[model samples]
Target: MHGLVNRALQEFVKDTYGADIWGEVRDQAALPFDEFESMLHYDIRLTKLTIDAASAVLHKDAASLLEDVGSWLVSNPAQESIRRLLRFGGTTFLDFLQSLEELPGRARMALPDLDMPEIVLQTDTPGRFKLEIRWALDGMGSVLLGALRGMADDYGALVVLEAEPGREGAEIVVIDLLDAQFAAGRTFELDAQMR
Candidate 1:
């Protein structure tokens, strides 16, 4: 697993829950190191262990916790870069939906070491879609569900999304776009506070 991925989880815990909670989670996870080196690669088990520990410490379901992490990835002020990156996917929610397939390749191009899962998007019909997430690690679909919900808000789109069980180590996310333009979303500019 990429250290960046673990670090994101670590940061999420610290930022959302607090440093003390993170310390407790680290102790529960039995991680030797206090911090994850973002450029390094750690065993995938460490990721699972951290999630489990955090889940235990927070009294939250692993999947639900991961979903919060996913939402944090895009909605948190600290993660504005990721939000910007995803926002670049499209001018509207539907454009973003169609552009999902390009994300992994774009991520790899930006950070060669950042390997992520392939997401296959299937349109069931107008305004409905299914996302097949081929994640080697569990809970990515929950994360995606959170991210999708956040992005839906960011784009001012009303949507219904849920994570469903799939084969081992995979997740299926269903999305129903209720309205593409529910409201004017948060403002995003090409430049920082260019307005």
Candidate 2:
């Protein structure tokens, strides 16, 4: 796992729960480092341990916690760089979905040693898209789903998400982009900024 992910988990727990809880979780997980370096790679077991500890402490499922972490990735002012990178995909929700297909490549460019997940977007029908993720680790499917949800909110797009069982090494996520209440104005503002 990447240190960025570890760092995010730490921040999410600290910000949402409390620093004290984060400290306890860290100790329970047997993590020696107080902070994770974004470009470094850590043992995947550490992430699983942290998640399990966090789940126990917060009394929430790992999936829910990961989803909230995804939301925090975009919604938190401290994560502006990542948010800006996401926005660079395009000005609209659909555009962003399409951009997901290129994320692994883009991520590799930013951090050459990073082993990013593979993302594929399929649009067989208008206003609906299917995202397939091929991850090297287990238990990250929920995190991907959460990130998509966060992206949907970031674009101010109304969306519904469904998860389907995938073949070995992959997970399929279906997204239904619904009619937006304020998308028009936001789109215009986005376009104006692009010009």
Candidate 3:
């Protein structure tokens, strides 16, 4: 089973990145080509898993750090429902920030020295958040924001990160690929659009 999978990976690499590099990689790794491909794939997945583990650890730490504050805010001498809303939104915002911080490091594992801007979260509704990220990339900002929306959706509500006003629309963003040097501020509103 492993051999078959490796063969498929090797074929994929050969067909994708070319055969010469694959041959050299296979020989230098000192394993059958199929096994070598499997090993490489395993290593790649392991790297991703490690980043995920690190993200989880940071998330736990962030939650723990905010737990006391959150509790106090919720259990304060204020209104009952107000306490609940503040607690829920505050905790969610902190967790989202922690997760966003881990993402840049995860991206670094794939592309070293990649510059990311400051990501801040604001909640205007229950189970909803608005993300303001100041990214410097020209054409890649919207794509990155879309990916972030997908990631946030997996955790909570639907996140829509977009530019401010008279800036960039999603439609133009999807097709325009220009290398410009300017800082862009985008707004991502997360809401219970579906869930």
List the RMSD of every prediction in angstroms: 1.3, 3.1, 18.8
Ranking by TM-score: 1, 2, 3
Better of 2 and 3 by lDDT: 2
Local accuracy of candidate 1 as per-residue lDDT tens digits, 121-182 = 99999999999898768888888899999999999999999887776666899999999999
Q: Give per-residue CA lDDT, model 3, range 1-195, as digits (tens).
A: 222223433443355447775555455444433333332234334322322332243343322322222233223343233223222222343354346535556545644544444454455555444445454322223333444433333334333344343244211211111211122312223332421
**Candidate 2 TM-score, C-alpha based:** 0.87
In candidate 3, stretches whose alpha carbon ends up further than 4 angstroms from where it belongs are: 1-98, 109-112, 139-141, 152-163, 166-195
C-alpha lDDT values of all predictions: 0.91, 0.79, 0.37
Instruction: Locate the minimum summed-lDDT window of 10 residues in model 2.
Output: 183-192
lDDT of 3 at 6: 34
lDDT score for candidate 2 against the true structure:
0.79
Q: Which stretches of candidate 2 lie over 4 Å from their true place?
A: 184-195
